[model samples]
Target: MNKKQKKVLTRIIIASVLMIILVLLPLEDYPLVRFILFMVPYFTVGYDILLKAFKGIKNKQVFDENFLMAIATVGAIALGEYTEGVAVMLFYQIGELFQSYAVGKSRRNISQLMDIRPDFANVMVDGVLEQVDPDDVEIGSEIVVQPGEKIPIDGVVIDGNATLDTAALTGESVPRTAKIGDEVISGCINMSGVLTIRTTKEFGESTVSKILDLVENASSKKSKPENFISKFARIYTPVVCYSALALAVIPPVVRLIMGIDPLWTQWVYRALTFLVISCPCALVISIPLTFFAGIGGASRAGVLVKGSNYLDALSRSKIVVMDKTGTLTKGVFEVTKVQAVDISEEELLEMTAMAEAFSNHPISRSLKEAYGKPIDTSLVSDVEEISGHGVKANVSGKVVQVGNEKLMNSIGVQVEDIVEPGTVIHVAIDGKYHGYILISDMLKEHSKEAIIGLKRAGISKTVMLTGDSKKVADLVAADLGLDEVCAELLPGDKVSKVEELLATKTDKEQLIFVGDGINDAPVLSRADIGVAMGALGSDAAIEAADVVLMDDDPSSIVKAIGISKKCMRIVYENIYFAIGIKVACLILGAVGIANMWIAIFADVGVMVLAVLNAIRALSVKKYK
Candidate 1:
């Protein structure tokens, strides 16, 4: 327990001992002396409550839980129920202690998940190892990460090989093998062997920093239910306070007017009990806690939710729209087939590779990788990239074009329509159609399972949006059993399509767009909930996305949705259980049928039960 909680516990123990002694003493004849003795222990365990009530009244912020607690216990003492008054405060303190401990436990769990922040990065400076802050390490600087040390910065492995413990980053227990030329993200522990890496991004832009930032600011964006509770409490507390006052005074006045005895003390005592039962502690505390636990649970499963608002929206998502490359498919392109019209296959490859050599697009890299030789950049000059079309470059003093069918037609070349189920790159040289290469990307092993999982989870429509050919998109969509497919779209067209889908969905439902490329950032931001494939996702897309899947597994998306639904269920349960019980007991308390013990159960007991239910949001194994 924290020091404050320990101190509160100590006070509770001391007060309980004193209260027991007071109850055993025969001080009925010396009422004044007995009152003074009881007051000593009463103030000891509950001074903070009274102090807070005073402060709230002074600040014109009355009618909070503290105020209600103070008024209820003080009124009990005034009615000569000193033992009940102290017991009420003691049990309330115990409940608060439980709440503090529970919240601290959940925060610690989240902190451990995000404990990947590096203390320092080891950089070789002037032939010596100098440990410096990761933020100070410049891009391209050689940093050495020894065995059992965290990879302090995102970079490329330049020397040595090791099995990386990526559980902290990806929540996968299996260790990943990293060798020279392989890209490694920050926050992963190097399990074995010393490794040298060339830093590629600054610390602020690294994966670890982005995740930490996401978690730290998550609470600022409250969910709809949380917002509703906040506003409800602001109005509910004041209205209840006035109702309690009316119960105390108006009932006695009505009895006097009806010629019956005005039992003022009895009605006042009932009003105090009514106030205790009406305290909104359960709804105020558990709703936000449920969402917090859900976020922590998702982080442990390698899914990071940026805010509770997204968590709430994800629970209501009925339509899931996803990008084709890197999201569902492995996004690794390979040259499956090459057709030559008027030249040999080697000549066609040479011209295509030379035109795409300077580009970093996955398809370009695949063509260059197929060529398997260094490009003579001197022969490839004046490279121009046409948006959504292809690349135009002067290859070997000949104007060569490498792109889609649109690019071939834009250059006034008569290109034959090739019906294929892969990303086709049409090549034209000196205004004549040369040939085409079919580069295909393999789908992720879990992509089909992920789609089925979403459908089983009650997603009404599964859509695939892509820039690939209609045949390739239709093939992937059919194989995955998607409800809709929109192909041959550029980045702008993607945002427009997302907007159209967004308009089609009901207000009660949300649309989720998942992507991984730099161009996907626009659509990611436009959708209701943007899910990014963080492992291979571009920084732009990650920054724009509301949720990030660290393992790049499409199946985790369904897991995330499940977590969201579970959290919302817990939240609503707490709200209903707390309010329903409070309202029932409030009615009984006003009618004088309930006493202090029953009031305590309605207030503190209900809060403790609600809190325990909120903790269930941390359980992800059930959803898995």
Candidate 2:
């Protein structure tokens, strides 16, 4: 507990002891003395509530729980029920303490992420390393990270190597190996070796800052149930207060009109009990608490939800639309096979690698990597690149063409047909058809399990949308057991496809789109719930998505859905449970079958139980 909460707890204990001592004393013989003794504990535990109630009325905001509480307890005292009034205040304070502690515990879970904030960055200055505020670090400045320090900005490693503990950013315990020329983001702890990084992004625009911004501002966007309870409380409080007044006055007047003995105290007592039962504390406190705990739990699992509204939407998601590359596949091209016509396989790869050596495209890099030898650029000349086709250049006085079928057709080379589920790079030399090399993007680990987990988590359909070919898309879909696949689509077509999918689902069933590329940004924004792979995701995709999976693992998407499902379940359960108990108790209290003690349980006891259930949303380690 915080110091404030500890103090409140101490007050509760003191008030309870005083109540017990006064109960033991024989003060019933002296009514004034008995009232004075009960007032001691009452004021001790309830001073703040009374003060807040007075301030609320002064500010013309009288329709609140504090106002309701103040009126009920003070009315009980006026009716000579001092002990019951004091007991109600005592138990109410206990419920408030429980709520404060639960909120603190949830806040602590999220605050642990604040450790990701870098204290200082080590920058090279005049042949010496100097420590400065991370925010002051400029782009392009070379920074040095020690074995135990956090990387202060997003940058490429210029020298040295290290194992990075990415748990703070991704919640994965496996350390990542960072070597020369590898891009490393901020907030990763360098576990071994000293390294120098050339900053690619300023500190304010780094990954750490964006994540912190997302986590801190999440509560500003409340869910539908929370907003409903807020509105319900606003209208319910004043209406109940006037109804209690009618219960106290109208029935007594009716008795007098019928020439019957009017039991004013009996009617007034029932009215006070009604006011106590109508506090609305359980609904107002537990609904938002459940969502907050759920968001915290998702963060613990490496998923970052933008707000509770998105979390709510994810619970009802029936269809999941995913981009093929970078979302399921690794997006890294690898040379899988080579078929050379009349020439050695090594010779064809070397010529193609040399011709495309100047290009930094993934296919070009894969060709160079397959060749496994340095290219002699001096041997190549007259390089030409054809848009949407291929590249042509002269190598060793022979014209070499490397591209797709469109490039082969333009060069008048009739290449033999190949039925492969990977990208085929056609080759030609001096207008004759040579062989082709096959390249494919490998699927990520847990990609198949991610699809299965989604089905188990209650997702109805899983679809793949990609710019890849029909064969390659079908291969990935079959491998991962996806329900549908849309292949050979441009970015705009992907958005239109998502719109069509959106039209297929019911209004109650949300459609979620997951992607990790700049091309996927439009579709991500167009979906009902956008999920982005944050570790390797483009900034545009992350900004557009409603939720971010920090580990870039497809399994985290399933975990995100699971967390949302659990949270929404808790929210509804609390809503139904609290309202059900409260409405039942309110009717019983109005009929004089319940006393102030029963009213106290109906209000404080229900809040305590609801809060305990809400905190259950924060435990997701054992979940999928």
Highest TM-score against the true fold, candidate: 2
Could you give me the TM-score of model 1 versus the true structure? Answer: 0.87
Q: Model 2 over residues 1-624: C-alpha lDDT tens digits?
A: 889999999999999999999989888899988988799899999999999999999999988889888999999999998889889999999999999999998889877854688899998889999999998988899999999999988999999999999887787889999999999988899999999999999888898888888878888898888889999998999899999999999999999999998899999999999999999999999999999898888877778899999999999999999998888988899999999998999999988998898889889999999999978999999999888998999999999999999899886777777877688999998888779999989889989999999999889999999998898898889989999999999999999999999999898999999998466879888999989875542477558889988887888888888889899999999999999999999999999999999999999999999999999998886345
**lDDT (Cα atoms) of all candidates against the true structure:** 0.90, 0.90
Give the alpha carbon lDDT tens digit for every residue of 1-624 in model 1: 889889999999999899999999999999999889999889998999999999999999998999999998999899988888888888888889888999999999888877899999999988999999999999999999999899998999999999999887777789899999999989999999999999999999898888888888889999989999999999999999999999999989999999999998899899999988898988999999999999998888888888999999999999999999888998888899999899999999999999998899888989999998888888988999999999999987899999987887787887777766687899888988878999989889889999999998889999999998788899889989999999999889999998999899889999999888466878888899998874532577567889888887888889889999999999999999999999999999988999989999999999999999999998787343
Over the full model, what C-alpha lDDT does candidate 1 score relative to the true structure?
A: 0.90
Measured against the true structure, the TM-scores of the candidates, in listed sequence, are 0.87, 0.93
Residue 394 lDDT in candidate 2: 96
Report how far residue 243 has shifted in candidate 2, in Å: 1.9
Q: What's the C-alpha lDDT at position 341 in model 1?
A: 90
In model 1, the runs with Cα more than 4 Å from the true position are 335-420, 423-438, 535-537, 622-624
